[model samples]
Target: MTPSTWSPAQPPAWFEQARHLAAVRRYQLAEELTRRELAQNPRSPLAFVVLSMLLWQQARYDEAEAAARDALAVQPTYDEAFYFLALSCASQGRSAEARAAIHTAIELDPASAKYYALRSRFELEWHYAAQSRATAEEGLRVEPTNLECLHRRLLALRQLSETSLAEETARNMLALDPECAPAHLALGELLLSQADYVTAEAYFRAALRQQPGLAAARQGLSESWKQRYWLSRRLARLDAWVARAGQWLTARGLGGHLVLLLGFVLVVPVVCLPLCLAYGWSYLRWRLAPAILLVRGRPLGQPCWQCWYRLICPAWRWPWGCWRPTASGARYGASRRPNQSAIT
Candidate 1:
């Protein structure tokens, strides 16, 4: 027998228990309860939406998508179902489908700032930075103080390299909620990108103090700590080439990997041999520079420590020499020299 459709003004007792269980993350009990609810009210769109939410939380995007579609089947005009459908599609990297579903949700509920905020998030992921900003702006217009919309706008600004605007947005967030961890986090990330480790670390620490569970803040703090050491900073700068090379290789797919393998095994040594013969002595000489300075009982200047970069990396000029990339393919400005006081 089809469960009689009644006014869902009062949720069933099991629905309340299931929500509580889900809130506390006892998903198995919650799912069991939800299934029981389904058994009693199999035609309930809300039950399917709840199930979709639970499945989405568990990272079961395919199942969540199906549950959301089931909800839509029960109620063609279910905006909530469309929202979950968009979330599941986005999680599965179906950005176009996600956008389409979210657009439908917005049409169904034009005044929903929540849907707009979510749509802005996926727009950013899809690399529509300008569109994301506009979506976020519209969401803010709908509800001026929506924190999620503000966060999305801040991120879109950051992606567009509008540092001043991003900072302004972050500060506005802090003004609205002084203890917002994500606000602190956004500022910390911006500072980190600008190589202001001290300020970045302070902001990251502040974020962690507010939200002890913020993994991004912890990671930023760790990176700030790592960048404090000279060797670590130089190694990171040196590895920038590796990251670029990996991107180039990735773009070319398997062919680039094959070339890389062949070059490393057969061509690199051949091409490097001549340079090695010429600079092999110089490398050994600098390799022993610290020892030489120590033996001479003279203070080791910065050059003694950093000559390796100058010799091997053509782009690494004298610290603070400041070169820019030219049409000739020269590039510069990866790392900076340590402060004289810090060096001392």
Candidate 2:
């Protein structure tokens, strides 16, 4: 078909193939197919959108945003293009632009529960917990059983200190999909905060069983182990108390920026001195952790990634700060990115 004579009202076979490949995470092959399709049909907005998705998967956020923009230029009403643009911009730390783009997308496709779910996650990640919860509720209104929205709602609830609601949301998620690692991880975090280390440890272990590479789950497992000891538990309690105090300051209608400022001026002055002394004790304990484990005849605690003993520890299951190993001995993509989503 000639360029001017043809419209991409129906995507070509290659476009479908590329979409399937991208869904299956065969990014390089999907990218190649998408590029070829775009070359043949330069005006195809959907082709550009696929290219944007491919680039985003590769973490080439600038290129991804450009491709999304190209899609928008080709078809001004392409909501998926705007959604991809928002994701790319978010990845690049252009938060305001990303929010605007996502708002456009949501306005264009109000029925798309995924858009609201994504927005909820964006809000939570950016520290707007109340807004995040609202967004998640919007998603749930569109699709009551949406797991993504439920998980984000759970997280937002936790952040807002609505523990009862958060636990109920987590139970709903587990009821929906027992294998959902994110739900398990959230529940584990909740239990950890409540000082229920044994139960939290089980949940963390379940999360890891479902997704071994989940950084947050691994970290939670290590934390649960640390708190099994009385001395470390006391230190952890002190840290949690300080954090709660900061939250109390933040709740008094302080500006978001002032929360940290007041935390430094008010909460930290009273808390951090003792916290620092506790940290000194923590450092000494961290150094002696191996000896303590040996004395207890327990190697269950993961060797601290930063500890000097990690290189020599038999219990070190994975590389430092990584759950997987690559040919280079460091995990590929092992820049310690936050385990944002629990799907591995």
Candidate 3:
């Protein structure tokens, strides 16, 4: 068809509804509505962009990329098309293309903090911590109250080990949003690293109070307690070792024992104490650590490690009893007889 003959088809009301739904973050319903609309007008760029966003939200990156390409082919300069194209490319490890597309988006809308935020996100995805921090900082300079910009800056600072800056940014974020769980968790981790156990515990507790399922905050709290416990134990052990060495020096009449005692009390605790404490900490973690996940506030009954391993390396269920249970009424009964279990 000639370019003049390429009349853009009018999208149905359902297509508009789907766009609204996607805008409001109701992705599943948007996907269904977009599918229905696409059935009627398959070549509509609007339809394709909506479908692309839905697939992107669901993390179907390859499908999202194809849909974005379809939209871009119909309307090459469409901003939303380019935006979703960048997202799909980023999701699938096409960082160079994603970066170029994001740059184009920013060029198209230089004043948009959302575009800068996307740039920061792509930098983070590529593990360019310093570049991500700069991008986020620039975005925040333009839009001072932008939550995404502040969050990105905080995360990048944390990753780069810029402790003071990260803590400051996290505190600012918390001041803006007291219920921000990640900010609280980040501040807690920073304090924990600095050996500020009491303050770290308070931050972690606050995070848990806001979001009980925040595993990072819970982990920070656990680590803070372990640190204090280990420090106390190490000091006690060093004192005992020193007392024993002093008695040895008195009995053997050797001045070397005093030196040895000093070395053991000072150097050994400096070096060996951390290692010993780490081992004990890990032992306690293995023994008393809570389950990594919970369902309805109860510990997950299924063995996640075994399930994850099975998922990674699939094997015939008939050869091994590795069938998983379903929440539905389908009972996955154990295979009693030989070759009775169906392969998953």
Candidate 4:
């Protein structure tokens, strides 16, 4: 159909539905509808950018990169295209490229909070936790109450091992949004790490209250309980072992235990001696010998017993064995000797 024949209403129906699906995080259906819209209007940069965002959300980084690039090719200054391209690059550990693309995006729209948010995410992935915090701080300066920027800064602090700062950030995040499960979880982790088990348990319980399916908080609580239990058990076992070893040393006497220890030490080496010798012999004959011969520019498969032995141990020299004369040496010798006798 011609561009004129495809009414604005037709594009809006698919685009609006796709956008709604994307809003609810139903990326798969959003992607399908966006593709359908693009089929109708192949040159639609908006459709391509939407599809790229959906692909990125689904963690299909390569496809998202391609789609985002296509969108940028159609509209070089498209902010959304650059944003998704940066996200695709960041997800795949291409931090330098992602940063460059995000810089371009920020240049296109300096006031865009999303561009700064994505840059912060890129810094976090690149192991520049300090830079991530700075980026998030910049975003907060631009949009004072941006929850995303606040969350990013909190996570960056946590990664940098600044637990006290992370706890404060988490409290701020919870004050802003009481149902923030991630903030509660972060607070719990900080508290647990500081050995404040009572407060940590309460935070973990509150996190679960906010989001019943908060697996990470549940797992952290479970693991913390397990670790405390195991720590006490391990200490008890260590104490028992020390007591038993001391009693044994005293009752058996140092000389008797020393003799038994010596015997135990000697037995391992005695058992390993034959295997070690065999391995050393094989290593020298196959690997070291052939390598030395190759270094000396000698034909590795020369008509020598050692070369033949090396050939038999093909694990050392593969194609070298293929050219070994040992297999045909007897025939060559017989042929040469007969010809020499006949001439004589």
Candidate 5:
């Protein structure tokens, strides 16, 4: 079976009991097994690595990092140990350290698709969409059937707003694995971006059917429902029509629109000039009237020009605060999508 579809019953024989315990989230028992293995063979890198994974499963990142380091000390060339160390560091928000460790892991085992996918995820988190896509593409080159790499590439393209390319990639993913939940969710998000609420909703529903507990798919479904409401749907249709009209006009060249704008400007000047004149007169009267109240015809404190400047040029600010944008925290369950190579 492929790595993504790994079953708990699969036999590696060496760490059979430990792996089974960890798979079932029995981290305490898994730790005991690893401890026994280490007692039997103190210099065994695999035992230390298992201990690291068990600690990682319990969110004990610092302890996990130490265990991974111990594994590396026992076997300097342990790529999987380095991979787990990177994951532990990343979970603790030490991104720079995490990136460095992940890079070292990749350098040691460039053929491992999981390393490349993790690197891509880091790049994307750092807002390096192009680099993320390149890394995922490299992973795909190494393992053409790797679903995680494909999904990472799709996500990177979406971040870059390369919608057409993202759509093609999503379609390719579905072709590779029709039952893949992430592929369905990716397609749903792509369609949602294009304002195809009806189709997007269907894709999200399909994803939910495949993986009922998928957080991202459920969040996508909620957003699709919000967009599919009657008023939002009507507004979306109008927006689409306007977009089509704009495209048609552009295809015909800019001259037509320029002529239309010219006509509007000419007509507005005639109607607006008199009103402007009247308003200007009233403003002058108001300002002079204020000055008349000043002693010895001296002007008031200030012209209040600052008020006008503020009105003309409002303060620069974002609608939201300076926080990184994120999806509705759609985390795949830790148990279902085990970070096997990277941590487990």
Candidate 6:
């Protein structure tokens, strides 16, 4: 049909296809189709609105806002076009412009629960908890069971520190959808803030069981385990300290020396004492044989003096050797050798 003959009653096939593709999230194909439709009917305001929405979904905010303005130029009363412009403006951090645009959209279509929900979310993003709560309540008044409004209300209450009310809202959401990950996570966070790690962990685990890839639930679960036991918390801190200390030592080339020192100090005491005693007794038996024969031409059972000296000396040396700064002294000596050579 000719452009002049076209009307909403006989919408183009391409426009229908574009809308369908957009609904199915096939944005690229839908965008191509919408542009083709717009090329044939430049004056079609709905086509411009659809193109704006397509651009908005693609995160081309400036282009989407321009396209939305074009839609408004063609049909000044298009509420959906204003809504798209608001969303585009919001994406670009134009909060005042977004609020004005969304207000215009709501004035054009006051009964739209989705618009109310969107406005409520915008308020929440802008940190206007009171306004967000009011907007969400307005939406709920219109549609009592709207999930978007319900979630927004829950978030606004939490932001306002209305803990009991937020918990009630969360429970209501769970009552509506038992497998809702956000509801479970909300309850978990509430409990966690109260230091009820055991109960919080259960809710966080439930959220994960419902939705395994939920990052908030995963983080909450990890935190729950860390704070669940005193020992775990202390160990976690110690591990963090050790990691930082290792990094600090490695930067100064002392990491390897520190490891060796710790092994010698802690491990040698436990292991070397037994091995040293065994070696001392064997060596004394062999050494005393020659000494006894030389002294009286008799076979010696054992030499107590040699045994005591060998055992005591090695044990003494083990700790004294560890205490001595052999590694540090070598590092110091090597560092000074170059300077000493230069001076000589």
For the record, the alpha-carbon RMSD of candidate 2 to the native fold, in angstroms, is: 26.0
Pairs in clash, predicted candidate 5: none
Clashing pairs in 1: none
Candidate 2 vs candidate 5, TM-score winner: 2
Candidate 5 error regions (>4 Å): 1-14, 233-344
> Residue 234 deviation, candidate 4, in Å?
6.4
- What would the TM-scores of all predictions be? 0.63, 0.63, 0.58, 0.61, 0.63, 0.60
TM for candidate 6 is: 0.60
lDDT of 1 by residue, 1-344 (tens): 00111123678777677677776778878787787789989999989988888888788999999999999999999998999999999999898899899999999988878888999998898889999999999999999998889999999999999999999999999999989899999999999989899999999999999989999999999999998789998899789988999899989999999998998999888989999887998987755554443334422343444444434543333333323344766333323445578878
Q: In what order do the candidates fall by lDDT, top score first?
A: 1, 2, 6, 5, 4, 3
TM-score of 2: 0.63
List runs of model 2 lying over 4 Å from the truth.
Answer: 1-16, 234-344
Measured on C-alpha atoms, candidate 4 has an lDDT of 0.77
Q: Which residue pairs show collisions in model 3?
A: none
Deviation (Å) of 115 in candidate 6: 1.8
Candidate No. with top TM-score: 2
Report lDDT (Cα) of residue 189, candidate 1.
Answer: 93
Off-target runs (Cα >4 Å) in candidate 6 are 1-25, 196-199, 202-213, 233-344
Write model 5 residue lDDT over 1-344, tens digit each, in one string: 12112223344465887777776777798788789878989998877877887788788999999999999999989888888898899989999999999999999989889889989988998899999999999999999988788889999999998989888888898998898888899899889878798999999999999999999999988988988778877887899999997887788678868876898999999989999999999986654432233222222342455334323432243222112133764221112343468993
Which candidate has the top score in lDDT?
1
RMSD in Å for model 5:
27.4
> After best superposition, candidate 3 residue 229: deviation in angstroms?
2.2
Each prediction's number of clashing residue pairs = 0, 0, 0, 0, 0, 0
